[model samples]
Target: MTRAFLRPDDARDLVAEQFGADRRLTALDRLAGGSKKGVYRLRLDDETTAILYVWATGENYWPPSPTVPDDPFTDASGAELFATNHAALAAAGVRIPRLLMLDRDNRHLDADVALVEDVGAVTLERLMEHDPAAAATPLSMLGDALRRMHTTLSPKYGKLAAITRGEAPQTRRTEDVIVDRALGHLDAAATRDARLANAHDRIAGHVRLLRSTVTARETYGLVHGELGPDHILVTPAGEPVVIDFEGLAYFDVEWEHAWLRMRFGDAYPVLRPVDLDPHRLELYRYAQVLSLIEGPLRIADTDFPGRQWMLDLAEWNITKALAVV
Candidate 1:
């Protein structure tokens, strides 16, 4: 009962109010949505057309915590960012979902959702669960897809100053800024300076190292910002398609790559630097694990593996955080 639901009519009426009418539209089922948006499954009258309904988040939207409101479309800027960013990616020859419509009104709907062509693909988590032998297959494709994403398209997203970036949930953040904000909540914001409590020095060191070592150009491209089996979808034909660009932003490729390794036991792609700068990677890895240790770090619960995932990442991070080297 952690989550609630918005009915098919409620979804349609709300979406229709913001998105306008679909002549022969059919009822839709609100399924799962991540941090900034709501995702719904819509079936056309013809039964052949499948449209994914997305509604961003907004305050006063519904009930409070403990039986969370089903609404996902809550913000205005995020919807706009999602549209333009994804559109740019598509135009750049990247394979992304086709946008059917986008709203930018910060009112009731908050212009917080977009309609896109849904693919009958299975999430990487489902694929991995169904067949373990097929697990590595997704990882390889993911590497190539991610490389293309980071190398080719990321630079297109210009970096805005901290305030501007912070305004939008799906903000473009350089490593330093991201660290400060993400770890800020963990800090003693209740106090005057909002100290990061026990984690201040460690987080600062990682942030400094990340800022100094990662050159801008090599990492300048658009980062998925968040990459996990859940965010990636592998089709029935074995094709890899990525979704959820809400958090897609400008960031360091290495930071993102280190996060990716956490999922596969921190031992994938042959585990480079495991022999060299393992300490640094460990710190980097722990920073991310620590983020997940808090409930708010997650985008959604569609594929969340629970505290086990967090504990595992934390264990790996702690093992490395304590490394004598």
Candidate 2:
């Protein structure tokens, strides 16, 4: 029989155990937007509220693919690592949720879960969508928050595990990790779509040019691997609080900025003083499209909502990237 992952009653029991025995879970409402985790808002009888996040494991979660190999992180230790990163980011003056408890052993749930403070914040994506013109303050705050995060330096480049283990992480070279992943994706795309063969050749040349012009920087820092507007939250007080540290890594700050630029237009100014090359930035932007394409490719057969839209967007972005290259 399939095991039930998480239900309201289970959440209530967990909350009761963490809070006093008399404390009761008055309400359990599932929040939306995470692809790999179940997020919920819990209200207690004492009128306090908290957010519960349950991570999916095994095949339920996306596995490493040729286009995006080297999965440096796992959900087994996600709660603990998230808490650690939260503390580090908070100390660096970046606003984030306070992790209350980590359920690693599945003592109260079927999978790994994290209980954190609910700050009553809205996602930056929603804010931007509501009023693009009024998003200036939050956008500026987001830039500042990213700058603060980058200040938390790492000794090496590539994955967070290597840095955390006190070992030198993977280094960047001309045929760096991103290039390899891009090539893999292009190969797959060409096999599925013959029309992409010419575009693949163009992208290959562009990758070579990108590597020739860009070199690894002396400084490496905490980079939010996925820094889309959706991951940022704007509190009721107009403060920007960054969330979702699972994809965090120790890599070039330029990659993070590149993601931000791809999500938000080029007009978004860089708040930090890191040297950025236009070509490198464009290459990273193209790489982001390649990474995005992996998702639709992985689930092409499934009945995923907006699958067509996702594929279309990937193709459109690929065309845009190729045009620039």
Candidate 3:
């Protein structure tokens, strides 16, 4: 029950034990691009490499209000949830890193950690920035992979718990969850800037309309809540593999589509086509903007850099979302 963060020696010891007494951990390098978790690239004496992901505690993770008493929307710790999600997605034939071992009980490490096979690939975000046209084939492949993943259906929609438990986590309707999150984020944004109050009211007025759009959907599917380019990696063989399952949930497919469209625009080719409702997508896009703002606003008091840039981007997106709504 150590309260201290896991150090390099701790990780090396765990990796050595998992591999063998003879096989030593040669190097442990912390990887970037994770906000809520710590990822390390580990190299062994045998020349094999792997990734170690340490899940964030509730205190460090975002979307939990520190000021509000009895905040019901806090995200549960992702340690066990990430392990469960990896198992479920791998079983469904999704292209994810091979999970070697999981430490959920915090016995081997201070926090939950997972040792996974490193694909030794570059992230799609870097590739896209270097050459968008050259990255087309891989992007299309990712679209196909996502289409396959969407086939994973669930009985109810909400958080990752619903997907793991195979039932709704609570009695509240999915529409209520969506609306409440939107309102919560909007309120948070308004607290930082009074100008956002009007935006909040405008979006609030359209809650019923937005709810109707979500309710009209006949089925719920597994959603990679944050499927941006950074989470996707392209292998040397030109295959795309997905990573980061902490945000996985059961929700309307349009929310996933909207995320891609907002991030990649028309350049991202949606291979497996669906009848997209533009109005609904726009509403969700607004919700997405609000969600993006929520995290930065919630942590504004801290010394986190790039907070202003995020708020600026959120404001810009809000303007775009408002134009359509």
Candidate 3 residue 37 C-alpha distance from true site, Å: 1.2
- Report lDDT (CA) for all predictions: 0.50, 0.68, 0.70
Runs in model 3 deviating more than 4 A are: 1-6, 56-63, 66-77, 163-173, 212-215, 305-309, 321-325
Highest lDDT model number: 3
Span of ten consecutive residues with least summed lDDT in model 2: 68-77
Angstrom error at residue 325, model 2 = 6.2
Tell me each candidate's TM-score: 0.64, 0.86, 0.86
Per-prediction CA RMSD (Å) = 7.8, 3.2, 3.6
Give stretches of model 2 more than 4 Å off: 1-5, 58-64, 67-77, 132-134, 171-175, 270-273, 303-306
Q: Per-residue lDDT for 222-270 in model 2, tens only? A: 7877778888777778877788876676666777887877676643563
Error (Å) of candidate 2 at residue 169 is 3.8
Clashes of each: 13, 0, 0
Ordered by lDDT, highest first, the candidates read 3, 2, 1
